[model samples]
Target: MKKRNQYSAEFKAKVVLEVLREEATVNEIASKYGIHPVMVNRWKQEFVDRASEVFKKGPSEAEKALEKEQQHVAELERKVGQLTYEVDWLKKKSDEILNRKRP
Candidate 1:
Protein backbone atom coordinates (compact mmCIF):
# COMPACT_ATOMS: atom_id res chain seq x y z
CA MET A 1 0.00 0.00 0.00
CA LYS A 2 1.23 3.49 -0.91
CA LYS A 3 1.51 5.99 1.92
CA ARG A 4 -0.76 9.04 1.66
CA ASN A 5 0.97 12.41 1.75
CA GLN A 6 0.25 14.79 4.60
CA TYR A 7 0.95 18.52 4.32
CA SER A 8 1.19 21.14 7.08
CA ALA A 9 -0.77 24.39 7.06
CA GLU A 10 2.39 26.40 6.55
CA PHE A 11 3.42 24.28 3.58
CA LYS A 12 -0.01 24.65 1.97
CA ALA A 13 0.07 28.40 2.54
CA LYS A 14 3.47 28.64 0.92
CA VAL A 15 2.35 26.68 -2.12
CA VAL A 16 -0.78 28.82 -2.49
CA LEU A 17 1.21 32.03 -2.22
CA GLU A 18 3.65 30.83 -4.86
CA VAL A 19 0.79 30.07 -7.24
CA LEU A 20 -0.83 33.47 -6.58
CA ARG A 21 2.32 35.18 -7.81
CA GLU A 22 1.41 33.99 -11.33
CA GLU A 23 5.09 33.96 -12.25
CA ALA A 24 5.23 30.15 -12.21
CA THR A 25 2.88 27.66 -13.83
CA VAL A 26 0.99 25.20 -11.61
CA ASN A 27 2.79 22.28 -13.31
CA GLU A 28 6.18 23.83 -12.67
CA ILE A 29 5.37 24.57 -9.08
CA ALA A 30 4.07 21.06 -8.53
CA SER A 31 7.20 19.60 -10.11
CA LYS A 32 9.46 21.75 -7.95
CA TYR A 33 7.53 20.89 -4.77
CA GLY A 34 6.89 17.23 -5.65
CA ILE A 35 3.13 17.72 -5.18
CA HIS A 36 0.32 16.86 -7.56
CA PRO A 37 -0.67 19.46 -10.17
CA VAL A 38 -4.36 19.23 -9.28
CA MET A 39 -3.57 19.93 -5.63
CA VAL A 40 -1.53 22.96 -6.59
CA ASN A 41 -4.36 24.28 -8.75
CA ARG A 42 -6.86 23.87 -5.92
CA TRP A 43 -4.60 25.77 -3.55
CA LYS A 44 -4.16 28.52 -6.12
CA GLN A 45 -7.94 28.97 -6.39
CA GLU A 46 -8.39 28.99 -2.64
CA PHE A 47 -5.73 31.66 -2.24
CA VAL A 48 -7.42 33.83 -4.84
CA ASP A 49 -10.77 33.53 -3.09
CA ARG A 50 -9.42 34.48 0.33
CA ALA A 51 -7.08 37.20 -0.94
CA SER A 52 -10.07 39.32 -2.04
CA GLU A 53 -11.56 39.24 1.46
CA VAL A 54 -8.38 40.71 2.93
CA PHE A 55 -8.68 43.77 0.71
CA LYS A 56 -12.35 44.32 1.53
CA LYS A 57 -13.45 46.30 4.62
CA GLY A 58 -16.19 43.89 5.69
CA PRO A 59 -14.66 42.75 8.99
CA SER A 60 -13.41 46.14 10.16
CA GLU A 61 -12.45 47.17 13.71
CA ALA A 62 -15.86 48.72 14.32
CA GLU A 63 -17.61 45.48 13.44
CA LYS A 64 -15.45 43.55 15.86
CA ALA A 65 -16.09 46.08 18.61
CA LEU A 66 -19.85 45.91 18.02
CA GLU A 67 -19.73 42.12 18.20
CA LYS A 68 -17.93 42.26 21.55
CA GLU A 69 -20.42 44.77 22.91
CA GLN A 70 -23.34 42.59 21.83
CA GLN A 71 -21.81 39.59 23.61
CA HIS A 72 -21.40 41.62 26.80
CA VAL A 73 -25.02 42.72 26.63
CA ALA A 74 -26.15 39.12 26.29
CA GLU A 75 -24.15 38.12 29.38
CA LEU A 76 -25.56 41.00 31.39
CA GLU A 77 -29.11 40.10 30.36
CA ARG A 78 -28.61 36.53 31.58
CA LYS A 79 -27.36 37.73 34.95
CA VAL A 80 -30.31 40.05 35.32
CA GLY A 81 -32.76 37.22 34.66
CA GLN A 82 -31.11 35.05 37.33
CA LEU A 83 -31.22 37.85 39.90
CA THR A 84 -34.86 38.56 39.11
CA TYR A 85 -35.81 34.94 39.73
CA GLU A 86 -33.96 34.92 43.06
CA VAL A 87 -35.65 38.16 44.16
CA ASP A 88 -39.09 36.79 43.34
CA TRP A 89 -38.41 33.69 45.41
CA LEU A 90 -37.26 35.80 48.37
CA LYS A 91 -40.31 38.06 48.13
CA LYS A 92 -42.62 35.03 48.24
CA LYS A 93 -40.90 33.72 51.42
CA SER A 94 -41.11 37.16 53.08
CA ASP A 95 -44.84 37.37 52.38
CA GLU A 96 -45.35 33.93 53.90
CA ILE A 97 -43.46 34.91 57.09
CA LEU A 98 -45.52 38.10 57.59
CA ASN A 99 -48.81 36.16 57.14
CA ARG A 100 -47.75 33.58 59.75
CA LYS A 101 -46.95 36.31 62.34
CA ARG A 102 -50.44 37.89 61.87
CA PRO A 103 -52.06 34.50 62.56
Candidate 2:
Protein backbone atom coordinates (compact mmCIF):
# COMPACT_ATOMS: atom_id res chain seq x y z
CA MET A 1 0.00 0.00 0.00
CA LYS A 2 1.27 3.50 -0.86
CA LYS A 3 1.46 5.97 2.01
CA ARG A 4 -0.85 8.98 1.77
CA ASN A 5 0.90 12.36 1.49
CA GLN A 6 -0.02 14.98 4.06
CA TYR A 7 0.22 18.65 3.12
CA SER A 8 0.62 21.45 5.67
CA ALA A 9 -1.95 24.20 6.11
CA GLU A 10 0.52 26.75 4.70
CA PHE A 11 1.18 24.69 1.59
CA LYS A 12 -2.54 24.17 0.98
CA ALA A 13 -3.18 27.91 1.38
CA LYS A 14 -0.38 28.70 -1.06
CA VAL A 15 -1.79 26.31 -3.65
CA VAL A 16 -5.32 27.63 -3.14
CA LEU A 17 -4.07 31.21 -3.56
CA GLU A 18 -2.41 30.25 -6.82
CA VAL A 19 -5.68 28.77 -7.99
CA LEU A 20 -7.63 31.89 -7.02
CA ARG A 21 -5.11 34.13 -8.77
CA GLU A 22 -6.09 32.53 -12.11
CA GLU A 23 -2.43 32.69 -13.10
CA ALA A 24 -2.51 28.95 -13.80
CA THR A 25 -4.89 26.04 -14.17
CA VAL A 26 -5.65 23.83 -11.19
CA ASN A 27 -3.89 20.96 -12.93
CA GLU A 28 -0.83 23.11 -13.48
CA ILE A 29 -0.68 24.11 -9.81
CA ALA A 30 -1.21 20.51 -8.73
CA SER A 31 1.49 19.32 -11.04
CA LYS A 32 3.88 21.93 -9.73
CA TYR A 33 3.22 20.80 -6.16
CA GLY A 34 2.94 17.09 -7.02
CA ILE A 35 -0.55 17.05 -5.45
CA HIS A 36 -3.92 15.97 -6.79
CA PRO A 37 -5.86 18.62 -8.71
CA VAL A 38 -8.99 17.59 -6.76
CA MET A 39 -7.23 18.51 -3.49
CA VAL A 40 -6.36 21.94 -4.83
CA ASN A 41 -9.95 22.58 -5.89
CA ARG A 42 -11.27 21.42 -2.53
CA TRP A 43 -8.92 23.72 -0.67
CA LYS A 44 -9.95 26.66 -2.83
CA GLN A 45 -13.62 25.96 -2.25
CA GLU A 46 -13.10 25.55 1.49
CA PHE A 47 -11.18 28.78 1.59
CA VAL A 48 -13.96 30.65 -0.18
CA ASP A 49 -16.65 29.10 2.00
CA ARG A 50 -14.87 30.14 5.22
CA ALA A 51 -13.43 33.44 4.08
CA SER A 52 -16.02 35.34 6.14
CA GLU A 53 -14.53 33.81 9.30
CA VAL A 54 -11.51 36.05 8.85
CA PHE A 55 -13.71 39.08 9.61
CA LYS A 56 -15.93 37.63 12.35
CA LYS A 57 -15.56 39.84 15.39
CA GLY A 58 -14.85 38.53 18.88
CA PRO A 59 -12.15 37.09 21.12
CA SER A 60 -10.61 34.06 19.42
CA GLU A 61 -10.11 30.65 20.99
CA ALA A 62 -6.54 31.56 21.97
CA GLU A 63 -7.73 34.69 23.76
CA LYS A 64 -10.37 32.77 25.69
CA ALA A 65 -7.82 30.15 26.71
CA LEU A 66 -5.43 32.82 27.93
CA GLU A 67 -8.15 34.43 30.01
CA LYS A 68 -9.00 31.10 31.60
CA GLU A 69 -5.35 30.49 32.39
CA GLN A 70 -4.98 33.94 33.92
CA GLN A 71 -7.96 33.35 36.20
CA HIS A 72 -6.45 30.04 37.32
CA VAL A 73 -3.13 31.72 38.06
CA ALA A 74 -4.84 34.37 40.13
CA GLU A 75 -6.63 31.74 42.20
CA LEU A 76 -3.34 29.93 42.76
CA GLU A 77 -1.66 33.14 43.85
CA ARG A 78 -4.39 33.83 46.38
CA LYS A 79 -4.04 30.32 47.81
CA VAL A 80 -0.26 30.73 48.10
CA GLY A 81 -0.69 34.01 49.94
CA GLN A 82 -3.12 32.44 52.42
CA LEU A 83 -0.79 29.51 53.02
CA THR A 84 2.18 31.81 53.64
CA TYR A 85 0.27 33.82 56.21
CA GLU A 86 -0.79 30.65 58.00
CA VAL A 87 2.77 29.36 58.04
CA ASP A 88 4.05 32.63 59.50
CA TRP A 89 1.41 32.62 62.24
CA LEU A 90 2.29 29.03 63.17
CA LYS A 91 6.00 29.86 63.33
CA LYS A 92 5.36 32.80 65.60
CA LYS A 93 3.24 30.69 67.96
CA SER A 94 5.90 27.95 68.01
CA ASP A 95 8.71 30.47 68.78
CA GLU A 96 6.73 32.06 71.65
CA ILE A 97 6.07 28.63 73.16
CA LEU A 98 9.81 27.75 73.04
CA ASN A 99 10.84 31.07 74.54
CA ARG A 100 8.46 30.68 77.54
CA LYS A 101 9.69 27.12 78.14
CA ARG A 102 13.37 28.22 78.14
CA PRO A 103 12.85 30.62 81.08
Candidate 3:
Protein backbone atom coordinates (compact mmCIF):
# COMPACT_ATOMS: atom_id res chain seq x y z
CA MET A 1 0.00 0.00 0.00
CA LYS A 2 1.20 3.52 -0.82
CA LYS A 3 0.73 6.54 1.42
CA ARG A 4 -1.26 9.48 0.09
CA ASN A 5 0.48 12.78 -0.67
CA GLN A 6 -0.41 15.78 1.48
CA TYR A 7 -0.28 19.30 0.03
CA SER A 8 -0.22 22.45 2.14
CA ALA A 9 -2.86 25.18 1.88
CA GLU A 10 -0.27 27.64 0.56
CA PHE A 11 0.89 25.29 -2.15
CA LYS A 12 -2.67 24.49 -3.22
CA ALA A 13 -3.52 28.20 -3.30
CA LYS A 14 -0.49 28.91 -5.46
CA VAL A 15 -1.40 26.18 -7.89
CA VAL A 16 -5.02 27.29 -8.06
CA LEU A 17 -3.98 30.88 -8.58
CA GLU A 18 -1.74 29.79 -11.40
CA VAL A 19 -4.61 27.93 -12.98
CA LEU A 20 -6.86 31.00 -12.64
CA ARG A 21 -4.18 33.09 -14.33
CA GLU A 22 -4.42 30.89 -17.45
CA GLU A 23 -0.68 31.17 -17.88
CA ALA A 24 -0.37 27.43 -18.59
CA THR A 25 -2.40 24.28 -19.08
CA VAL A 26 -3.60 22.30 -16.01
CA ASN A 27 -1.57 19.31 -17.24
CA GLU A 28 1.57 21.40 -17.23
CA ILE A 29 0.96 22.64 -13.70
CA ALA A 30 0.18 19.14 -12.42
CA SER A 31 3.34 17.69 -13.97
CA LYS A 32 5.48 20.49 -12.56
CA TYR A 33 4.03 19.92 -9.08
CA GLY A 34 4.24 16.08 -9.37
CA ILE A 35 0.51 15.76 -8.60
CA HIS A 36 -2.44 14.39 -10.54
CA PRO A 37 -4.26 16.64 -13.00
CA VAL A 38 -7.59 15.70 -11.41
CA MET A 39 -6.27 16.85 -8.03
CA VAL A 40 -5.24 20.17 -9.53
CA ASN A 41 -8.62 20.62 -11.15
CA ARG A 42 -10.40 19.77 -7.91
CA TRP A 43 -8.42 22.35 -6.01
CA LYS A 44 -9.08 24.93 -8.69
CA GLN A 45 -12.80 24.27 -8.55
CA GLU A 46 -12.89 24.42 -4.76
CA PHE A 47 -10.93 27.66 -4.72
CA VAL A 48 -13.23 29.33 -7.24
CA ASP A 49 -16.31 28.10 -5.42
CA ARG A 50 -15.21 29.41 -2.02
CA ALA A 51 -13.53 32.64 -3.19
CA SER A 52 -16.64 34.62 -2.19
CA GLU A 53 -16.14 33.54 1.42
CA VAL A 54 -13.05 35.73 1.60
CA PHE A 55 -15.14 38.86 0.93
CA LYS A 56 -18.08 38.12 3.22
CA LYS A 57 -18.61 40.54 6.12
CA GLY A 58 -19.25 39.64 9.75
CA PRO A 59 -17.84 37.00 12.08
CA SER A 60 -17.68 33.39 10.90
CA GLU A 61 -19.34 30.54 12.77
CA ALA A 62 -16.11 29.46 14.44
CA GLU A 63 -15.51 32.97 15.76
CA LYS A 64 -19.04 33.21 17.12
CA ALA A 65 -18.65 29.86 18.89
CA LEU A 66 -15.35 30.93 20.38
CA GLU A 67 -16.92 34.15 21.73
CA LYS A 68 -19.82 32.25 23.25
CA GLU A 69 -17.39 29.81 24.86
CA GLN A 70 -15.38 32.66 26.33
CA GLN A 71 -18.50 34.21 27.85
CA HIS A 72 -19.51 30.87 29.35
CA VAL A 73 -16.08 30.43 30.88
CA ALA A 74 -16.21 33.93 32.35
CA GLU A 75 -19.61 33.24 33.89
CA LEU A 76 -18.33 30.01 35.39
CA GLU A 77 -15.28 31.76 36.80
CA ARG A 78 -17.43 34.46 38.38
CA LYS A 79 -19.66 31.84 39.99
CA VAL A 80 -16.67 30.02 41.37
CA GLY A 81 -15.31 33.21 42.92
CA GLN A 82 -18.62 33.98 44.58
CA LEU A 83 -18.90 30.44 45.93
CA THR A 84 -15.35 30.57 47.27
CA TYR A 85 -16.03 33.84 49.09
CA GLU A 86 -19.22 32.46 50.61
CA VAL A 87 -17.43 29.33 51.76
CA ASP A 88 -14.67 31.39 53.41
CA TRP A 89 -17.25 33.55 55.23
CA LEU A 90 -19.11 30.47 56.42
CA LYS A 91 -15.90 28.91 57.73
CA LYS A 92 -14.93 32.08 59.60
CA LYS A 93 -18.38 32.30 61.22
CA SER A 94 -18.24 28.63 62.22
CA ASP A 95 -14.81 29.14 63.83
CA GLU A 96 -16.10 32.15 65.80
CA ILE A 97 -19.08 30.20 67.07
CA LEU A 98 -16.87 27.30 68.13
CA ASN A 99 -14.52 29.62 70.00
CA ARG A 100 -17.45 31.33 71.83
CA LYS A 101 -18.82 27.94 72.96
CA ARG A 102 -15.42 26.98 74.46
CA PRO A 103 -15.32 30.02 76.79
Candidate 4:
Protein backbone atom coordinates (compact mmCIF):
# COMPACT_ATOMS: atom_id res chain seq x y z
CA MET A 1 0.00 0.00 0.00
CA LYS A 2 1.32 3.46 -0.95
CA LYS A 3 1.06 6.44 1.43
CA ARG A 4 -1.08 9.36 0.24
CA ASN A 5 0.72 12.49 -0.94
CA GLN A 6 0.62 15.56 1.32
CA TYR A 7 0.36 18.91 -0.47
CA SER A 8 1.93 21.99 1.13
CA ALA A 9 -0.05 25.03 2.22
CA GLU A 10 1.52 27.21 -0.44
CA PHE A 11 0.66 24.75 -3.19
CA LYS A 12 -2.91 24.42 -1.95
CA ALA A 13 -3.26 28.22 -1.76
CA LYS A 14 -2.00 28.59 -5.31
CA VAL A 15 -4.49 26.13 -6.67
CA VAL A 16 -7.29 27.62 -4.59
CA LEU A 17 -6.45 31.12 -5.80
CA GLU A 18 -6.53 29.96 -9.38
CA VAL A 19 -9.96 28.55 -8.75
CA LEU A 20 -11.08 31.82 -7.18
CA ARG A 21 -9.83 33.82 -10.15
CA GLU A 22 -11.93 31.63 -12.46
CA GLU A 23 -8.93 31.00 -14.60
CA ALA A 24 -9.94 27.36 -14.79
CA THR A 25 -12.76 25.05 -13.70
CA VAL A 26 -12.48 22.97 -10.50
CA ASN A 27 -12.12 19.81 -12.58
CA GLU A 28 -9.33 21.37 -14.62
CA ILE A 29 -7.45 22.54 -11.54
CA ALA A 30 -7.76 19.13 -9.92
CA SER A 31 -6.51 17.46 -13.06
CA LYS A 32 -3.57 19.82 -13.31
CA TYR A 33 -2.65 19.18 -9.69
CA GLY A 34 -3.50 15.50 -9.85
CA ILE A 35 -5.85 15.91 -6.89
CA HIS A 36 -9.55 15.25 -6.59
CA PRO A 37 -12.05 17.98 -7.42
CA VAL A 38 -13.55 17.71 -3.96
CA MET A 39 -10.19 18.52 -2.35
CA VAL A 40 -9.79 21.57 -4.57
CA ASN A 41 -13.27 22.79 -3.70
CA ARG A 42 -12.62 22.31 0.03
CA TRP A 43 -9.37 24.28 -0.11
CA LYS A 44 -11.13 27.04 -2.06
CA GLN A 45 -13.86 27.21 0.56
CA GLU A 46 -11.35 27.41 3.42
CA PHE A 47 -9.37 30.09 1.62
CA VAL A 48 -12.47 32.20 1.01
CA ASP A 49 -13.62 31.82 4.63
CA ARG A 50 -10.27 33.03 5.99
CA ALA A 51 -9.75 35.75 3.37
CA SER A 52 -11.19 38.36 5.74
CA GLU A 53 -8.85 37.33 8.56
CA VAL A 54 -5.90 38.21 6.37
CA PHE A 55 -6.89 41.88 6.53
CA LYS A 56 -8.32 41.93 10.06
CA LYS A 57 -6.52 44.33 12.41
CA GLY A 58 -7.87 42.90 15.62
CA PRO A 59 -5.55 42.58 18.59
CA SER A 60 -3.79 39.35 19.54
CA GLU A 61 -4.95 37.01 22.29
CA ALA A 62 -2.86 38.72 24.95
CA GLU A 63 -4.17 42.13 24.02
CA LYS A 64 -7.74 40.89 24.19
CA ALA A 65 -7.10 39.43 27.64
CA LEU A 66 -5.60 42.70 28.84
CA GLU A 67 -8.59 44.64 27.56
CA LYS A 68 -10.94 42.27 29.35
CA GLU A 69 -8.95 42.67 32.55
CA GLN A 70 -9.06 46.43 32.27
CA GLN A 71 -12.81 46.34 31.79
CA HIS A 72 -13.18 44.16 34.90
CA VAL A 73 -11.06 46.58 36.92
CA ALA A 74 -13.17 49.49 35.79
CA GLU A 75 -16.35 47.67 36.78
CA LEU A 76 -14.96 46.88 40.22
CA GLU A 77 -13.97 50.49 40.73
CA ARG A 78 -17.48 51.64 39.85
CA LYS A 79 -19.02 49.18 42.29
CA VAL A 80 -16.64 50.30 45.05
CA GLY A 81 -17.58 53.92 44.44
CA GLN A 82 -21.27 53.09 44.70
CA LEU A 83 -20.75 51.17 47.95
CA THR A 84 -18.72 54.00 49.43
CA TYR A 85 -21.45 56.50 48.60
CA GLU A 86 -24.10 54.28 50.17
CA VAL A 87 -22.06 53.90 53.36
CA ASP A 88 -21.50 57.65 53.69
CA TRP A 89 -25.17 58.34 53.18
CA LEU A 90 -26.12 55.81 55.86
CA LYS A 91 -23.60 57.28 58.32
CA LYS A 92 -24.95 60.84 57.78
CA LYS A 93 -28.54 59.69 58.28
CA SER A 94 -27.60 57.90 61.51
CA ASP A 95 -25.81 60.97 62.85
CA GLU A 96 -28.78 63.25 62.05
CA ILE A 97 -31.25 60.94 63.83
CA LEU A 98 -29.00 60.70 66.87
CA ASN A 99 -28.58 64.48 67.04
CA ARG A 100 -32.34 65.07 66.94
CA LYS A 101 -32.94 62.63 69.81
CA ARG A 102 -30.23 64.22 71.95
CA PRO A 103 -31.52 67.77 71.36
Query: Cα miss at 32, model 1 (Å)?
Result: 0.2
CA lDDT of each prediction against the hidden true structure: 0.89, 0.92, 0.95, 0.92
Looking at candidate 1, the ten consecutive residues that score lowest on lDDT are 52-61
Q: Return the lDDT, model 4, position 51.
A: 85
Give TM per candidate. 0.47, 0.59, 0.65, 0.54
Best lDDT among the predictions, by candidate number: 3
Each model's number of backbone clashes? 0, 0, 0, 0
Which candidate comes out best when scored by TM-score? 3
Q: TM-score of model 1 relative to the true fold?
A: 0.47
User: On residues 1-103, what C-alpha lDDT tens digit does candidate 4 reach at each position?
Assistant: 9999899999999898889889889999899989999999899889888788777798866789999999999999999999999999999999999999995
Which pairs of residues clash in candidate 4, taking residues 3 or more apart in a chain or in different chains?
none
Off by over 4 Å in 3: 69-103
Candidate 1: tens digits of C-alpha lDDT, residues 1-103 = 9999998879999998888787898899999999999998887777777776678767777788999999999999999999999999999999999999995
Q: Tell me, what's the RMSD of every candidate?
A: 5.7, 4.0, 3.1, 10.6
lDDT of 1: 0.89
Q: How far in Å is the alpha carbon of 7 misplaced in model 2?
A: 1.2
